[model samples]
Target: MLNVVALMGRLVADPELRHTPQGLSVTTFTIAVDRSYARPGEQRQADFIDIVCWRGTADFVCKYFQKGSMIAIDGSIQTRTYQDKNGNNRKAFEIVANNVHFAGAKNANGNTGGGYANAQPEYTREAPPAAAPSFAIGNNDDFSVIDDEGEDLPF
Candidate 1:
């Protein structure tokens, strides 16, 4: 009854944007997701996944995303069947993206250039100092963990 998926990967190529007869926008793209494990002496493998975005999401992707852009996707897996040109039935699988996020690295100018001119972060320094750690190493009265008697913590 529950269906959900999350992926972080780089775009295989620029998304193909198109309009339906009803004038609705749609965009299709592929992302290369690398596998976490590989056999010894073998290189890591990657799987190219197809993604579909509709309307506002499609427009945002076409305007901002480009080939090789790293992206995070939150959506659900969809499967459908169609006949290929060879007159054989085929099954297609893709993600129906509810949200697509920017995942590319920030460049030297502190910009994440995913085809769109990047925006600068609030802490705009050449290099920021390391942040201080919050937790105490030894016992500290202020940071005591209360046991919940094997019950989930109340929200």
Candidate 2:
């Protein structure tokens, strides 16, 4: 059995960190994810997805992420049924975040925040190897030209 999800979207609001009765950290927030395609002449749509984080991941989100920030989350889908205040039963689906990360460039202040334990490494370019291997670029004798004009070609 496999259950996994990866999402990138803008935060709808600041994450509010909470704690369980046993002192475990937790946070729940929503993100707006734009649809991949839109109808002709119509505006693109977006879906508001709920996400939940636990322990250190929850604290990282609350401390570094805020309203409108681009966030990346890796997690699994979770569902639960509960009774609403109006006495109606409802089912809720959300992602139980295993990891959360920054998904966009730095702000005007040039601050990308101090990375957490699971944060990905910053993007950097490394110099090429000193002794670059040379390749034969003009060697046409190793290739064969096809004369068929698509009539005998297999699709």
Candidate 3:
């Protein structure tokens, strides 16, 4: 009975925001989700998924997220049917987002947009491990070598 879909991917283009007659906000965008598996010697494939958000989520996306921004979306699949130009019925599938999150690295300006309602600190990458302390004995005045004490020492 679960119809939830969760995906993390990069946006293919800026989200398009629209307003309904009643003044409800809506945004539609596509994201490129890379396939998990690829054949040897072949490039990995990506699926362009259509996503839809309503009201506040739509406004948040338009205010921050942009093309090529990585995002995590949690939603349910929805299919709607409409008539094409030739009067043929067409069905389109999309995710109706209940949650939107930012997942990309910070830019040079140090902004990761936002996750959910605002930027989630959990998305930030950890700093690289610090370099190990130097242990070599240099030719400094502080080092003194003793040979008669029978004390084993590491140089």
Judged by TM-score, which candidate is best? 1
Q: What lDDT is obtained when candidate 1 is compared to the true structure? A: 0.87
Q: Please give, for residues 1-78, the per-residue lDDT of candidate 1 as tens digits.
A: 988999999898888789999999999999999999999999999999999999999999988888888899999999
Instruction: Kindly report the root-mean-square deviation of model 1 from the true structure over all alpha carbons.
Output: 11.4
Per-residue lDDT for 41-120 in model 2, tens only?
Answer: 99999999999999999988999888888898999999999999999999999999999878878667665533332354
**Where does the lowest 10-residue lDDT sum fall in candidate 3?**
113-122
Report clash pairs, candidate 2: none
TM-score of 2: 0.72
The lDDT values for all models are 0.87, 0.88, 0.88
List where candidate 1 sits over 4 angstroms from the true fold.
108-110, 113-117, 124-155
**TM-scores of all candidate predictions against the true structure:** 0.74, 0.72, 0.73
Candidate 3 lDDT, 18-110, residue by residue in tens: 999999999999999999999999999999999999999999888889888999999999999999999999999999999998788877666
The clash numbers for all candidates, in the given order, read: 0, 0, 0
Q: What lDDT is reached at residue 67 by model 1?
A: 82
